[model samples]
Target: MCVMSRRGRFQRGEGRHLCNLSGPPSGGSASPGSFLPLRGIDLKKGGRVKKPGRKALVSKDPYLRLLVKTYKTLARRTSSAFNRTVLKRLLMPRRFKAPISLSKLIKHMKGRENTTAVVVGTVTGTLLYRDMMMYVSTESRRSSDSAGEDDLRVNEVPKLSVCALRITRTAQARLLKAGGEVLTFDELVARSPTGSKCTLLRGATKAREAEKHFGKAPGTPGSSTKPYVRSKGRKFEKARGRRKSCGFKV
Candidate 1:
């Protein structure tokens, strides 16, 4: 027998019986019924499952791995934001670590002359002008072979000390030749424990030619996006929908 409760549902009662707390009262005890309501614990609410890690790192280069380990230690020990940033960048792929040229470095380091320039990628060589005891002469208008090494100029290019993951052969030579220093990651750690007096520089990311074709439809008005075409010939994409005579403008 079952008894109804005030809610009109039959809840489980004493042994071998069911109780409908909302309905009329029933017999005291009844045979054990096969049907039993599922317990509350059986139903699982929807939720987000915990994952192992935030994101997996994708890198296998031994040198990069070493740098990551070094910076990771520094990041945890000193609690410096610069070290943390460097560690994060070290774990990133090669694309994010773009190579910087010597010319750009020179331009950026103009005002911050004393501070060390740090690049997470390779550094390419650029021409450096320095003041030396070299002779210079201009050819005479009267004679073609009248020029000789005579005058000297004191114009000198400033020396730049930099730290980077990699430096080109020519760049290293030029830096060393100009009384500049090129230090590695480990060396940088030893020099500046907390990355003080350091300026981080990144390559021009949007300077790549491929970025020009990344926005808006190519043929749309006021859109400057470049279209994918084989060549710039007049007959290539200049027909039909592209011209009003053949069809409507696209």
Candidate 2:
């Protein structure tokens, strides 16, 4: 038998065979002159990148989901830019499509005869204008007798077709009473897929009081932004911003 060390070799019939090592083989590190190996992560641009949120809606309401699904299909099938716009608005947050008042609708839809007014959000009632009061008086006898006089001069409210996500009870009843129609968004989609003969309207986004305080600082020169103060008085923010005597007038 031949003496064996780290490697055990035996000669049998003029052929030499080596014994296999029990543990793992070692001592195969790269030399100093050899190129360094690159890691998987380092080979790629792996940092987080900023991007816009998903455009599609994830509403829990079944009806809204159904509407979104329908609109998505329609938007994919049809090339109408109007449908595309409606889909985008439908996916937007409720604040973006704030509720619109009937008075605003009347004002905007003026002279657009036989056209459907579409609102993506709720449709609310307005303080009855003199003209609308007359229309409301005839249909709703609950009004005071002074409102219903045959000989009295009154303005006539124009008949209109309104489409909205929701309509307040008062606005709905008034519209129906005035021979005007109240339509759901689905109905509008069915009636005018391409938004033909329709006038799309949105609420005044800047009308909110909170929006007043959103510009430059209250005391900044030439800045008309509103400030959030407890009260408006001489002791309040009226010193530096209001008069040149205190420090400097804005």
What are the lDDT figures for the candidates, one per model? 0.73, 0.73
Q: Encode model 2's per-residue lDDT on 117-153: one tens digit a residue.
A: 9888889975645554445545444444556632222
RMSD for each of the candidates: 11.1, 14.0
Instruction: Show model 2 residue runs off by greater than 4 Å.
Output: 1-54, 130-155
Runs of candidate 1 with Cα error greater than 4 angstroms are: 1-56, 127-156, 240-242, 246-250
**Clashes (candidate 2):** 0
Give lDDT for model 2.
0.73
| C-alpha lDDT of residue 4 in model 2 | 34
Residues 123-176 of candidate 1: C-alpha lDDT, one tens digit per residue: 987544344334445433224344442122422335888999899997887678
Instruction: Provide the TM-score for each candidate, comma-separated.
Output: 0.65, 0.69
